[model samples]
Target: MLSFIVLCAALWVSFHLIAGYVAQRLPLDWLADLPIIGASYGWERGGRCYEWLGIRVWKDHLPEAGGLLRDGFSKRQLASAEPDYLDRFAHETSRAEFGHWLTWALALTFFLWTPWQMGVFMVVYGGLINVPFILIQRYNRARLRRFIARSARRSARAD
Candidate 1:
């Protein structure tokens, strides 16, 4: 049981790391306005939908993995308003969301060695852990995109 547990942990970590690496290399434009990742009606509406989830109360309690890699971008704080920074931050949110989704799918590997009941448990566990992070990324990305658009319109008017 111990070895099986270790294997599960390793698989989860490996999947997330690979997903993060791939996300970093992906073009920002590719993630931008991706219909699949695009904000839904509630998320687009100032991310108010998240308030119902008590997101503000527990979001910070999750382990912060943004800084795990040496060159990884940390989303803990918004340090700058520069276009490039905001753009990259926006891209990072999509990246994080993609990573969670991929990791959740990869959890299926747990079933290969474990029994069916255990597999179901692993999958459920994966969802329980990843869903909140996924929602956070989506909520943040929606807000950030809205802010960027407003800024763009303001600049256009000034010009």
Candidate 2:
């Protein structure tokens, strides 16, 4: 059991490293525009479950440069809210979220090597940690897109 846990940990690390590397190298424009996942679908509009996770409070604790597994390339800063920047950041964020989803899926595959009980435990554990991140990504993307839209409308009116 201990060995299994250690192996699973190693697998998690490797998946993150490899996935992040691939995501960075890929031309992610098409992937970023993937509508289904990119649409926050009102998840960020109001009393979101993410607020309960203290994401706003805790997010910055992570290194801005992420790590080998995640370059943290898409993080949005209020100070840099230019429309073009927000648009690009939102797409970058969507791409990162996709990478994270893949990481969770790839890691969960190894749980098959463990007993059923352990596998279930691993699945729950993975969700607990990754879900907040998923939520944060969706929330940020939604807001960014909205801001971009508003900016466009304003510019059109001005013209």
Candidate 3:
């Protein structure tokens, strides 16, 4: 059973990596527009719940995690407010949104091979861990999109 769980995890990671790579190589921004991924139902909005959950605090504790796949902003420009930086970071979040869901699906599929109770545990545990990350990506994407829009307006005015 332990080995089965580990195999499930490994499968999840493998699928996630492949999906992420493909998402980067192809144009999949549209995938993020889907309701769950995009949080079209106001999930991305900042509110008391997020603060109470300490999402920001938790994220700060592992700042390195946010930059795992690709460095959103290089060290020297971590404080830079460049438009290009905002765009790159937004794209990264968008890709991550898709990757997380892909992982969720792969993890859930393990239910086919595991005992009913173990399957339920895997699904629940996967959600408990990934949902916050998904929400964070959505929240960050919302902010990044806003910033990118503002930057576009500023650039247009300058032109």
78-146 per-residue lDDT for model 3 (tens digits): 355788767667666766767666666666676688778877887787787667777667666676677
For model 1 the TM-score comes to 0.85
Would you list the C-alpha lDDT of every candidate in the order shown?
Answer: 0.80, 0.68, 0.63
Score every model by TM-score: 0.85, 0.77, 0.70
Give me the displacement of residue 125 in model 2, in angstroms: 1.5
User: Between prediction 1 and prediction 3, which has the larger TM-score?
Assistant: 1
Report the C-alpha displacement of residue 104, candidate 1, in angstroms. 0.5
Candidate with the greatest lDDT versus the true structure? 1
All candidates in order of lDDT, best leading: 1, 2, 3
- Candidate 2, residue 69: the lDDT equals 40
lDDT value for model 3: 0.63
